[model samples]
Target: MTNASDAAGDEKTKTANEKAMAGSETDTTSPASPTVRTEHEDDLDDAFKYLHDHSNAESTSIDLAALRRKIDWRIVPIMFVCYVLQFVDKVVINYAAVMGINKDLALTKNNFTNVGSAFFIAYLIAEVPTGESTSSHGANKVLTHILQDISSRNFHLESGWALTCLSGESVAQRPQEQPTITLFSPHYYTKSEQAPRFAIWYSGLGFGQIIGGLISFAFQHVTNKHFKSWQAMFVFVGIATSLVGMATFFILPDSPMKAKWLSEPEKAALLKYVSINQTGIQNKNFKMRQALEVLADPQLWLLTICTICISVSSGVITTYSATLIQSFGFTPKRTALLNMPSGLVSIAAALIVGFGVRKSESRWAWLVLCCIPGMIGGGLMSFMPASNRAGLLAGIYLVNAITGTLTVIYQWTMANVSGHTKRSVAAALIAGSFSIGNIIGPQTFQARDAPRYYPANIAVMSTQAGGAVVAIVLFGYYVWANNQKDKRQAVEEGLSSSAGNEKILWENLTDKENPNFRYVY
Candidate 1:
């Protein structure tokens, strides 16, 4: 009496149920036992397929600690170098401004500010398409490495004394993939471990700041008649970045499943271990429903607003810090030297928050803590007399504390969001929001408000405060959502909320759809 499609569906479901029962009955400690298949094989995450084909009971006995270490050593360094190069490439112009880029380009009025803003505008435009492509394809190492190579080449070409605004626009379009690198860790880490891992790579921002300063200082001494100091610095960094890109292409794996260094048993064990995240390893299916859900999701909006608010301060720090430092009457050489300490402050803040989140699991508290220093710094910058160069410099360094907050936010999105399609969209939206704030950030520094730039300083203080409040709201929302899920599960099952939770881990459900999935603030 049933139709062909219904008969086929029933057969598939029956087979899946049989496989599940068989898997459950097998010896848990036996290395040779076949992988367990879930009841909803077609709808479940791609990780389920990997487990069915490659994993065994041996995964239960593998030494997870040793495996984690091996994975870390292989991948983390490549991630760190990529981040350092990305930030350095983007911020080189900030140093160039001090090293006579403005005079060389004959820029006047708000032209420099426009150049800064142009990059983010391009970033914002590229974000959605980039996310779609990464989701449709995979966020594999090969795709990312190719983007890095292209970015390096773009920087190299731009260094050839192209028109300032045009060069900024061209270079801005390429670094969109850099944030996508953060997407790689969820495949390799659990929710508890991702914060520190993310911090390790994100700290490259600090290193980039330090290295950019040194590079600028070193190149400022260049006396070549044919090449300006900024141009030489760009060319040198571009070559170095291209080489790193080449290295990454060869060294990095697409995913834990594809890692050549790991034995098959090791790969299986690692996959089994990270499955607790409930956020699948990879799923190429681009569900339109999932993408549409991102538009209505309250979490996405709140996180977007928070990202924008915090990134405003980030924008100010990234593009204008050198110019601000130089405005205090320091020479270009001294300005470059002074900028080095800000990097140290950034590094310290990132390490503190990274470890703090790992130990305390209080991401909301750390986020607020970061904002406090930024607020203090902004107040000093806004109100302090121009004569107090030392106080202003201290304020500049303290503002770098907020950079750590972005790292926390990055890990938050990965830990909390699930359903590969939804996660991809959320990541892109959050990154695009960052670009929005950065776009707003440079424009705040109008030419009329030069030197002290009171309005720009006040904007930083306000945005930091706003970000803190939104983070608290987001924390509360997660708690409320978790409570609702617990209540619903208790009522439906007449038992504990966690009953039969493991079966749903690989079901490829979004945070909203998964009753067992708990959000971490």
Candidate 2:
């Protein structure tokens, strides 16, 4: 009896949604190309009966856990490794700081810091084209090139081609494969299941940090006369990063409907399952209105602001963790070993929150939960005396826990936002804002504020606290907006409260444009 009533209620809600969408100019009613009624279309629908059944679940017999595991093996590794390479590419320089990069490169006061900042500035400039072009062209063709610059240290090659390939093999020569986060998430998992998987994949950041530390440490023992220790570190990590990028370029599936590994039924079922995401399989048509909507979106700006705050903390740590340890008067060798544990802290926090989001109902609360530790770590660093080395080191470890928050914000944006162009633009803007903060973060470690780097530590803590307040404000805004929508629906359409609760999936509506689109709190 209960199942029957539930089914009836769901049907009623779905009917109400269809009525509401028809009255409004929404994407579901947008014209699709008239089907040529070919045998190919017939084969697709026949093999799996859900190609056109966008809202219904047709195959519950397939074990979700087993299938998700399969998807994990195929999809997650390249995303993780490429991201790891991206971090290691940036992080090797931090290791270089302790390894005599300053003396070798003839780096003077603030020269090292400037080199660090230069990469992000280049990253900031590159993101606009990376986002726009990758969305228009396929992720395979353009992303491989743009992401190479991300992993390359070429931004500091102000000295021309000589400095570019100084390693006998240029780190810049590595394949630039920027995995499209927006494209992949919608294709593989439902919004509810995405956070944990993204968290696990994002755990790659911690792994990369650990790998980078080991690489740097091992190179320190290098007896080879041909290459300097830091130079060897770059060459090794760069080559390994390139191999992974090439593998990803060839292996990663572009869409659920087109994945080579999946049988036709499996492909159709996967496509049917993710269809409620409302993001079309792939759209080449870039809309200016959606691009403009990105600029106009207040929530997107809030998301961007939150990411900037978190990324600032990341930037400070990435560029300066080794430097800070060295400033404590530890030898360069020991400093490398001490830095390895921060990655472990980050991994623990990332997995905790990733799985936490999977189990919990609220995402905003989780964001604030992650921020509290960052705030505490910042306070410890700000107020504690420099002599309290153990206390300060503990605080540094605590601060790394916030590194996982970047993963959270990325997942939130993916789960909540829809419309292909709008999501693409939003992803680009968030990435850009993240780079902008990183660009700002290292500059906080001015040469004048050397040794303790108190100013940078203070920035990490304060920005985290401010971000928490902004998250609550955004949460309130979502709740208030949801209420306003409900009242309007009642007044305008005489919709009952239950009917007003209906939401339109698979229509690709932006949160602002669709009354049925509810914000994730």
Please tell me which predicted candidate would have the highest TM-score against the true structure: 1
What's the C-alpha lDDT at position 180 in model 2?
69
Find the 10 residues in a row with the least total lDDT in model 2.
Answer: 1-10
Give me the runs in candidate 2 sitting further than 4 Å from their true place.
1-61, 146-179, 223-226, 491-507
Q: What local lDDT score does residue 236 receive in model 2, on the 0 to 100 scale?
A: 75
lDDT of 1 by residue, 282-356 (tens): 777778888888898888899999999999988898889999999999999999989989888888888788767
The whole-model lDDT of each prediction reads: 0.77, 0.66
Candidate 2 Cα lDDT to native: 0.66
TM-score of each: 0.90, 0.83
Clash pairs (backbone) in predicted model 1: none
Model 1 poorest ten-residue lDDT run: 1-10
Candidate 1 — what's its lDDT? 0.77
**Candidate 1 versus the native: TM-score?**
0.90
Candidate 2 local lDDT, 1-521, one digit each (tens): 11222122234324543453332222112223122123433322221222443323334355544566678788877677767777787788789889877776677788777777766775666566555566666665554553454435423332323342332133222222332654576677766567777787778788878888888888888656545677777777666666666676677755665577876546645554554444445655566787788887777888888888887888888888899888877988888888888889889888788777766637788889989989988888777888998878877788888766777788888776766678777777777777778778888898888787889989989888877887888788778877887787768764443322212333345666655555656
